[model samples]
Target: MEPSEHARLDAYWRKIASEFAPDPTARPSSLLVTHLLPERPAFVRAVGAVSELRAVLPKPKSVVAAARREVEQSYRVDELTRERFSDPDDAVAYLESRAAGERIILLDVGGYFAPTLNELCTRFSGTVLGVVEDTENGHKRYASGEKLPCPVISVARSPLKDPEDFLVGQSVVFSAEALVRGRGDILHGRSAYVLGFGKLGSSIARLLHAKGVHVTVYDKDPVRRAQAMAQGFGVARDRDQALSAAGLVLCATGSLSLRGEDFPTLRNSAYVATVTSSEDELELSGLPAGYSRSAVGEHITRYETTGHYFYLLNGGEAVNFLHGASVGPFIFLVQAEIIAAARTFTRAELSPGMHEVPAADRSTIAAHWLNYWNR
Candidate 1:
């Protein structure tokens, strides 16, 4: 007997799901471990499900091999640099070749550098500058710490372009792309106020305005405020002017004050979300001091209390850390663009204050990722 249309559709959906679904029954992939420390070995394997977790222990050497593979495959040295580096020494040599005439600015913290590797990287970089320390709201990671032999600058308390000697790459560039080119209309035509006018906030405003959203931007800095006005944005002189007349409020300033009281002046129907950092927990407003809350996390909280739906992201964390990573191809495209910029600019001069990744490189990365995805 022929299956019904609904049955066929169900089967098709199930088949699609099976392709991407985590395989519980399949044996876990082998472990590769490498422990630089003699006493401790590094472990490598994607862990998921109970059975997968039970797989054998990792050996340090194997981890070393896996890390090398990650560096090579992810960096695509064969295509980008036209040569392959098999070992750490070779990789160091390759980086040296690239850095022979360039200045390298590294943000060191979070155990990102080991004492030995730190010495090695310093030696490898022709001109190495040290970051001061990671700060509460900015590129402190890139600047914070003991300054290296070369010129060191603090990203937290300085504009990037002031000391234009090196290039910055190797991170997400959502703000730049979203601002200059606009983005998918997640909140179009909504009365919106954006707090913060740095890279992320500026990008959000640019995209929101393109979608016809009336954007009132509030930044404490007069210079940034003027820049917003120059871009045809409604510049709010203070929080009152910003929060007073809006249905949606977006915090991209990396401000941690997205609590309910911050927007006390907002209309009762106004909703709030963030694109800077991911919020871990969400709480509803307008109820008793303590009300039932949603157990949602990882940014993307939708609340329906007063007959209107309000959304909050990661409690209000960086949007990219939540929804952005899920769109792997989108990120790959961005990274590829950055990589191309790294390749091109390795041959040129770089200006400061977080330079925008070049457009041609962005195009190349986007095209490569798109083609790869289609394939």
Candidate 2:
């Protein structure tokens, strides 16, 4: 980056740090793994302000290369550490090596460092402070683990995150629409199947409906389906039927909601996308024999089998990530919540288990967000 651009970015982060300052006493050394988008500098600075930032691990597969380079240059992250971020095992080992004497906290998104969580906690014991997870997928991963040795604080479901989640849903629809329009097709007035009627899914459904797309909502939970129905959305009583009918299918469940087995039932030429960062939302490996796939557009792929074809947006990864995964200024609320969560984890005596960001912390962050933005 040029001097002017660097100065501007530094000034932006400094303002964020001032506005969202956490407790000064809770500055534990931290290892962070999150999407390295341009907007993330503010988050990095916010977290760094309240912690001793040991390493910043950008998910190699998901990070925007230019943005990653900018952050690396701006932060002066060394080449050796940058090399380690490319491999998960190496990243974990690096963090393990850093946990010898000082208290080490982990701030992770999507549980990118989850595979080694157990070993890290087991080996480091008291040295490993805890983990602060940033997404629902990561929260589920840590929650499902067998009795972790340290607290796993989740800001994913915090009320402060609701706005971010809603904006994520909007971004999913926006990116999908942009891709479809690029292919000389229109999404308005078409049918769409939205899997997982969670906050994100529901927002996408409503946004699509507002855009004149006929949307059908499906969820594994009966209550969510009922809620969708109550909200006047067409609930998918038959998953395969819905899949076979819609021209667009969006998976937001953060799991393998769409598998290869279900691909055969999808409408030919249907546009499939996801809202989660990983490919865990769609399982394309189970595709039957004779299936063929090829890139059809930037971050779009065409898959053909059984005399039919469907397009996968962003390689079945989160569609929004292709566009920097930004939710604008509201994301700062959640970032501040993360900083607060990290501070709480280090200072408090929380037990070894899954925990939510305390309501008090959230309120404080929300107040700061309002004050900062309104100012």
Candidate 3:
């Protein structure tokens, strides 16, 4: 280990020395194997005593496959439900069967699943899993139970990047980037109006903020509205205010409450889009000339003459979840880490019930994601 790494580990070890001490008859602490292991494990001796302990990391391919399969399995309850499972009723039946009388650890990474999932959780007497999605809606659900039937599991932080590395040479980092590149629209100067401050909306705000775009947010919930302001976002108390000024309006509220009349004030030059809701369902027919809608892809195409707007990039799904491919791998990885550690600490099986996935697990997951980025 380099001197800095060694020093950092030394301080970490000192702080948690009691947790790593050997127990005469118990399994050795995984903390030792995980936290104390060298950044690059080698056959060299001076590394550390804990480095000698066997450590097992899950295969990234397997992890990705499992997640994809789960997404496929959860077609009904997930927002991607409409695209993947043509029949909503069938999907609901399957979800109900799986959730009946069980504890669920839902790692809601986006706000799409909550509405239906919340109903399912209440109906089946099973808990909804984690609410660690990156939107204000999820955060509000976690903070207040007014709209939720059961308690929230937890909320997630942003994905981690490797401290020492950046980017994969040729691979797409985010689905949005692919769409943006494909559409040839520069997002740098665009003003994005996000209509919601929930988990998913908050995440979108952060991304746009980081990209140097002016982001104005709107949410009726006072708490969420306050939270957005505290984060240095311009909070739009009224939806019209946000819509009239933005170059692009991204509907992130996960609510169908918005109506055609609500957006009549939008300027013809402004593009209308959403991370939630399908283009066909957006009721954009009455939109003025120079507006259009399209699916989420890497690039966006504008059809101003026809009043058509393409929502390209990430399948028009929650921007953050689709960004997970490169920019947010830690989103899932952190949830996995929390699941793993929760399992380890409680010796509990992964089941249904609203369970708190730890934030530390998320940090570790972020670290691993960053490591992958470097490699």
Candidate 4:
């Protein structure tokens, strides 16, 4: 079925159809995705799913492989015409080689590194219009003064709806539940330390607190710390204070907040997980040398840190997207936000600066989501 026809039944699809305006300055036939998206099927199928989730994207196998190949086998990769890159530099090099009139839509999760984005903004400027950023790390860069080419959109924390609050709530329930699955009442009376009192951290702290765990929130920002304290969640007085006797340490801050120096204080059997969009949120570099490591199956990694066992789900990537299968559908809902944001770049006269999903478009996504879910 044509994309328009599918839009008839799905409000989300309809919104995508209406929000996506073709670029007036360039053609948009090609696409490139990358490591920024580790195992996200929603992004891999974003373009094609505008027709509906099940629609087979007529694009070649190369299109699906633009990022990770985990989802490629499940999608239609009928051709090998488009370029795919596991290395960010290779993708950058490809952009540098593009001639005028060869612009294609670029969907990336991590083009935020100054040097990488600089290459695209200068050497490969105008080679593409759709530079969709789907993570908090990427959003932070847009807030930076560096200018890239035209057409950029971010769905991580859009001003329009900013569903991070809702998404994080769901993520906590699922990720926390995963940590306790078949493991007895680990959270019933344990001390839970959550780094970053941002949307995700607050939610995790709230849920954990409700579960009878002592929730302590650690955020470098004073305002956020006050918010956590006001919410009845314990605020970490200091960095080391946050890890003191923490039975469960969860990192929600997108920064390298959890590191090796903090490990010595992480109590034995203290479970550590990252619930942020960026993997570096829990800096593995902080793990002390000579720590034993093993895979505990189901994408969980067990590490002996400071003479205690620490379980890092999905290699400290986003736990909700990995071991928390129950959290899957909700993240997909956030993907609707992503699709809406990307659609904005297609038509809006945007600049190199970071941008959010417009209010009108954000409302469309929320409405369509409610309609689709019958909520």
TM-score per model over all chains: 0.42, 0.88, 0.48, 0.74
Give the per-residue lDDT of model 1 (tens digit) for 293-318.
35343334545444344445445444
Better of 1 and 3 by lDDT: 3
Candidate lDDT scores, in order, read: 0.40, 0.78, 0.44, 0.58
lDDT of 3 at 30: 19
- The Cα error of candidate 1 at residue 156, in Å, is 8.6
The segments of candidate 2 whose C-alpha lies over 4 angstroms from its true place after superposition are: 1-26, 74-92
Q: Please give, for residues 1-375, the per-residue lDDT of candidate 3 as tens digits.
A: 378755643443332222222233322211111111122122111112221222222212112443334333323222233322234455346455545544433333334344465555555454433333433334443444445544444433333312111231112223444455555666667787877676556776777787788989888789999999999999986777667777766666655424655555665545555554343225545445554444433434343344423343343333323333342232234323333332332233434333454556555545543554344
Q: Local error of candidate 1 at 56, Å?
A: 22
Model 4 lDDT per residue over 1-375, tens place = 356534433445545545553444522533433332332443455555432122122222112243335455554332212233334565466555443445555554544333355555455544455566666655666555455555567666664324555555666557666656645535666788888877767777877777777888888899999988888987778778668678777887766767767766677667777765433576577667878889865656678745567666567666665432333234445566666665565556677666667777667666666665564
Of the two candidates 3 and 4, the one with more favorable TM-score, higher being better, is 4
lDDT of 2: 0.78
Sorting all predicted structures by TM-score, with the top scorer first, yields 2, 4, 3, 1
All candidates: CA RMSD (Å)? 16.1, 3.6, 10.9, 6.1
Model 3, C-alpha of 63: deviation from truth (Å): 13
